[model samples]
Target: MKIIISEIPKEGLDVKLKEKVESENISSTVIAQLRIEKLEIEVIVSGDLAAEVKLECSRCLKDFNSKLMIPVNVVYHPVEELKGEDNYEVRHEELDMDFYSGEELNLSNLLKEQLMLNMPMKPLCADLCKGICPVCGKDLNIDKCTCTITKTDPRFEGLKKLLK
Candidate 1:
């Protein structure tokens, strides 16, 4: 969605965007609400974004679906006005402030950025997920493995003599 800064009225603008994003790593239909308020020469956009995404479990490597909701708040100022000594700093009231160079504001880029930021570093299907057995390549979650799970580091072997 695109928003023209000059077109905004005194009452502000309400925008709703819903569409499927094309990416192999992420599949989502983003439902976003954007409220644009013109404060002086700046455009303040604030809303909430929700989506259902497919994520791979880090432990079991299984695919699963999860829902996410992220709050969107940004202030766009002209790039020219934000350069040099007169550069704007993010004040206490405007923590999500940003600068825009173009005549139009592109919301798609912001939504994509937010989605990337909201992704989990380590996705897990379950907290207690028993991952695949490394020795025989068996799924430990489904069945018990006969393989002896041991960590025999060469450095730790010297410590065994002290116990003896």
Candidate 2:
């Protein structure tokens, strides 16, 4: 979704879109609300994006729903503005800053970046989940296993005698 800078006129552009994003283990359906305020050749995008993603719980591997909110601010300039400089630093006034080769902005790429940034590294359903048992693969939280819990080290036998 690229918007031509010249087409924006003097006021600004307001846009809202609904899109779907697919990743390795998750698929997110998102709604993006955008407001573009132009400053000379540069445009500032300020908006809120919300999405619902399905993720697997790290402990029990159960699928769960996760909600994501992405707030975006980006400054875009014409490619001519960056002709002489190879390295440039983004300022506080700038967000999602980019220089375009043409008159249109590539909105799809920008949206993809925002979605990737919002994904969680490790998703958990609960903090204190008792994971599956290593031997029988039973859920430790639901039932007790018949396997005996024992310390196997012979070196600890002397310490065990001391306790007695």
Candidate 3:
């Protein structure tokens, strides 16, 4: 979704929308809940986007469906005003009127940012996922494997002798 800065009035504007998902593009349907309130030429976007995506579990390496909720709140600044400032600082009160370049606002970048922030660092299907067996590379959650699970250290030979 693109919004032209010139279209928004000084009093600001509000937008509520829902985006549909295509099976070819994304695995799950996504809902984009947006509230765009304009302050002069700048626009303040505040909302939460929720979606369910199919992801592989990091530990078990199994496919799973996970829900994501991304909250967004950012100010758009005018391109001309944001140029050549060594230390650009905006006040808390000015958050509603952040500047951006050009009269058009690209919602793709903002959506991408929210998705990235909401992504899990380490995704797991379950807390106690048994994971896969190291030797035969078998998924332990499905069935038991005869692979011997051991921990050995080359520097521990002397320690082993002492214990024996």
Candidate 4:
């Protein structure tokens, strides 16, 4: 759905979208409920989105599926304002702002951007994941490995040799 800036009605536009995005890390249907309102040269988009994402657990290194619910609140400014400028420094209030080119705004692209931005840095399958074994290379969560685990401080090696 492409929304024209100049055609926005005074009562605002309510959009319900179910868009499929296929990318490197994500392949699922994004469901978003957005409200778009244009105020002079600025456009405000506020909504909530939900999607199912495939993620790799950082600790156990296993593939898992998780549901993500993200809240979107973005203010868009026309990119025409920065056409002749080489570089523009954003202020503190401009951190959450986005730029729109021309009169059309591709809603599918915006929903995809919101999905990527809300992904967790470290994904976990479970809260108590035991991870993998350091010695024999086995998943500790599946079964207990027979390898003996020990903790040795490298700095105490010389001190232990002097005592011996």
Clashes of each: 0, 2, 10, 0
Q: Write the per-residue lDDT of candidate 2 for residues 1-164, one digit (tens) a residue.
A: 77877888678889898877776755788889999888877877889889898877777677778888999887877778777888965664545676677778877666777888878887876677776777777777677564423434677868867998
* Candidate 1: residue pairs that collide: none
- The predictions' CA RMSDs to the true structure, in order, are 6.6, 5.6, 6.8, 6.6
Better of 1 and 4 by TM-score: 4
User: Quick one: best TM-score, which candidate?
Assistant: 4
Model 2: runs farther than 4 Å from truth? 23-26, 134-136, 141-164
- lDDT score at residue 33, model 2, on the 0-100 scale: 97
**lDDT string, candidate 3, 113-141, tens digits:** 56655668778999999899888898999
Residue lDDT tens for model 1, 7-82: 8899999999996765657779899998988888788889999999998888888898988898988888778886
**Candidate 2 weakest lDDT stretch, 10 residues:** 144-153
Best-performing candidate as measured by lDDT: 4
How high is the lDDT of residue 120 in model 4?
A: 88
Query: What is the lDDT of every predicted structure here?
Result: 0.81, 0.77, 0.71, 0.85
TM-score ranking from best candidate downward: 4, 1, 2, 3
* Model 1: per-residue Cα lDDT at residue 26: 77
Sorted by lDDT, highest first, which candidate order results? Answer: 4, 1, 2, 3
Off by over 4 Å in 3: 9-12, 20-28, 92-99, 148-164
